[model samples]
Target: MSPVFSASAEIDDGHLHVLITGEVDMATADTMFQAVLREPAERVTLDLRAVTFFDSAAIHAVVRLAQQFPGALTVLPSRQVHRVLDISGLGDQAWLRPA
Candidate 1:
């Protein structure tokens, strides 16, 4: 079966709440990346609680977005997602939250 991935964003409390679901592999990472790029908010919070699986591509996409936005991005990753961020050395970035 083909991997499924999707992301949606909403602005709340002066921040963009991005909800991501499904597996985040190379094929689907771009959808998440585009969602982040399209958000027009001062801050971004990514909710990854529903993400079942993720790969380096997803990690890199988040890192790239954080770099592009500087102090404007925040990641509210689930426990499992946190592990991937930790392994990618991106947990130390200022934008990563709930660490």
Candidate 2:
């Protein structure tokens, strides 16, 4: 089956905010990944409050983004999203901030 997902982005005050919804898995990682990386900004915040599902591939994409931006990535996640991040072993990642 195909992964059900969609992403939208907006720029505000020199920052990029990306909102991702649905399942972020192998099938949807490339688009999601590229969308966030397509533009450069002073900071990038990924809002995952509406994400219903997220897999390891999505986790990897976030990791790559963190590595590329260093202290420039922040993630806003709901409690459910936090569980997914925790289960995927990113709960303790220093750069993965919750806001």
Candidate 3:
């Protein structure tokens, strides 16, 4: 079966806010990544509190976006996302914040 997923993005005051729900594996990583990167913004907030799965691809996408945005990206991670990122040693990044 297909992985469940949905993503929405909005820009306000030069900040891009993206909300994502569902699985974030290879199949949906690009979708989430593109949604957050589609527009130009001075800052970005990625909300993943409803995400159920976060795989390696999702981690890669997050890393890439973090690199692209530098100190301008913030991530609100769900339990699943926090677990994966913690295990992957990326949870210590300055951009991760409690939901």
Candidate 4:
């Protein structure tokens, strides 16, 4: 099993930067979602480059964040994240930034 999920957030100027590491699974996706929701900003940069594991529930959390911020959301995905996004057919979403 991967390490337990962890996340941190900070705001600079009008951008909210969220960094997530460890496993993002059914047990942790909701916590990840709520962490981002707590910081409302004109722009959001989600850094998932350190994610060791990713799952469908985590994908739902990411999609919900995209819906919440739309064009203002940018995701930096790790290899794990990219694989699942590709499998889920969301790899081409406009919010994704090359990782």
lDDT of each: 0.82, 0.82, 0.94, 0.90
Per-candidate TM-score against the hidden true structure: 0.85, 0.85, 0.94, 0.95
Candidate 4 TM-score to native: 0.95
Model 2 pairs in collision: none
Whichever of 1 and 4 has more lDDT, that candidate is 4
Name the top lDDT candidate.
3
Pairs in clash, predicted candidate 4: none
Candidate 2 shows a clash count of: 0
How close is each model in CA RMSD to the real structure?
2.1, 2.4, 1.4, 1.0
Better of 2 and 3 by TM-score: 3
lDDT of 3 at 76: 97
Which residue pairs clash within candidate 1? Answer: none
- Estimate, for each residue in 1-99, the C-alpha lDDT of model 1 and write its tens digit: 743677888887778888998898898888898887786778888888888888999998988888877988878787778888888787777877773
Residue-wise lDDT of candidate 4 within 31-86, one digit each (tens)?
98988888769999989999989899999999999999989999999988998898
Clashes in model 3: which pairs? Answer: none
